[model samples]
Target: MSIRITGLRGENRIGDGHNHKGRKVTSAPSSIGFYLYGALLLLVCALKIPALVRRPRDTLLRAACLLLLSAGLLMILAAPHSIAGLNRHSGIANVSAPVVYVMTTIFSGASLLLIINWRPAPAEQTRRLTRLCLVLYGAASLAIVLLFWAGDAPVEQRTLFDVHYAGTPCIREMIVLYLGAQGAAMTAASVMCWRWSAKVRGSLRAGLTILAVAYLLIVCFVVMRLCAVAARWTGHDLDFLVDEVSVLLSAPAAVLGALGFALPLAGPRLAETVRAIRQLRQLGPLWRALKDVPTPGAVRVPLSWWRNPPAVLLTGRKTALYDAILALTPHCDPEVRDAAHAAALRAGCGDADAARAAEAAMILVARERQRASPLRPPDATGREVRHAQAQDLITLSRAVTSPLVHHIRDPYMPLQKAANHE
Candidate 1:
């Protein structure tokens, strides 16, 4: 059960316990990498915890938060310094080994549960398979604890503990149990995500694709560790694979998985923000033109110090525009719209642009008429106007400031002037 390092010259020998032919083994690089990965997972936990608390009945969000929190805790505990401290505080030799193994197994089970809840299959089938996975992994975790409890390893090698004591009594069984559970979870996650990625679109598809790659890397980490353990039984050393290669793989795997889970939830909100900003910019000209008209108290300006200006402006602009349109409905003239449409067509505008320009011209004339007469009763026989859609308002907004619309409105200005002269 003695650990031996393989030399560069292809010789198996026991040198200074921490070195292979005078090369010192160090966990500093891996420790830093693990810490960064753990920090990111903790940040994700921080972001999701509030949402989970807000929607306590949302099973999907709760499961995802639990998975992230557990993974973060596991990474922190598995770091080199934390592992040594844990062993020291427990007063039991190699006690950290069992603790880390149990945590890793639990995290793996949690990850599988997250995926299962994310994209569930038929109700009965999904429930049955989910139950089966939980029971199997639960049993595997129990076996890991039992085996580690029976094992004895005096030396504390936090970074390479599994590799160093692979052949020791009961330690081999513990490693096998952990690797088996992790490997199974990774395999299922990779397949499920890859298959679903192709079926989806936009951010969800990209997230699933990234998740698939992350799971594949985790699978490689598990396979490499298992090979190192198996190599011990065959009198061949593959410690470098477990110590060096797997560390490199695991860090990126954790990071990519965390990002993959985050993208779908965050992407939509980001898009909505961009859309709101654009709408605020687009509605500026129309909103300003209608601002002079006095509307009811319900259309008061949305002044807020805390909210984003563009989002607040968008809400305020929509409300004001709707109110202005309702007020101008009584003054709308069909003949004026027909004349403006013809004028727009003569100005080299296309059919759709001419129609929008016509609508803008009629609205401008109505605004002027409303300004002249303080109050006007609703016309019973006035042409019924359909409520303008958001897209219609955007089209009118664009045409409102166009030169062609102004040209059409210019002819009607003489009438307002003549009425004033009287």
Candidate 2:
């Protein structure tokens, strides 16, 4: 909405003036674009609402939601039927112009505010800049209302207000004011996005690129619409610019704009979900081994914990493994670990792999001992077990199930029973 006539040309078309000469548009966008736009807006709103509810104080999220809602309402109000209904209710000829223009200006301002909030900046500077935008756009909106009152257009031109009244005194000033305000915002947004896209990567970079392209299209639409209106002053018939050319630019811009905004938020989240699922699967064996061990500190991860963020699920899974390990620390026999480490190194495992194998051997034996005699007196004290990382957990999980750990579990495997104690 942050471009001149792109916001104004919702369902408008050329008047039957002397200049309605270009071939009519295919009308596909005219029929389908609005519905697509509405659906996308609803989807985006639904996506953002959950996050906003979770973090009610997020300024960026609030602005984004406001911007989306404004865009949806602007389209609805500027529709042909909506305009005709507005005119009929007010009993005024072309009364919808000021209303639609004001809404467009509001949407343009909201878009600018959202972008400013999105980029990283000092709080004080961002606040000052945002305040300035509000003031400037607000003044322009007031001027639109004032000029609409001063202008006298008794003719009811639903779709051709700008073109039909191009030379009309105050209405021309009003059109130029709103267009200038909206165009300036869109051009600024386009330039900002183009420059920022270079500094980012992945889905965010692509999203910014899409936004830049969409804003540029709006700027071009505005320029073409301005030329169309100005041509009426020179008595030339370029009304075809608005009637035929607008759909091509504005429809695609609307779609790209929505995609651009949604992708940045969705892409990383999707990737994280996949990673979380993989992590859960890789550690399933380790989790199953400790399933019988009562959790230390009475901490229990809920079955519905997966509904939380991926990080939360990952943290919970890792913590459960370590908590169960710490509970088994009193049963850890260092000689058993040393014996397994030597056996693993003898079997061609690298030092790190041998250490992981040795740790898994001790854990497998401790699980069995803990279950076999939960009240056994402790021989080991203050044993330190390292917290498991993702790759380490995967390797350790596999090692725990390996034949080497099974061999270490045998009672007659030359395991020392604290013999030669001083």
| Best prediction by lDDT | 2
* TM-score of each predicted structure versus truth: 0.81, 0.72
Show pairs that collide, candidate 1.
none
Compose the digit string of candidate 1's lDDT tens values, residues 118-161.
88478777677777877987898889889977887887555566
Candidates' RMSD to native: 5.7, 6.5
Q: Write the per-residue lDDT of candidate 2 for residues 82-102, one digit (tens) a residue.
A: 666788899987778898888
What's the lDDT for all of these models?
Answer: 0.73, 0.75
Question: What stretches of model 1 exceed 4 Å from their correct place?
Answer: 1-18, 26-62, 231-237, 296-298, 308-313, 369-391, 414-422
Cα error, candidate 1, residue 56 (Å): 8.9
Task: Report the Cα lDDT for candidate 1.
Answer: 0.73
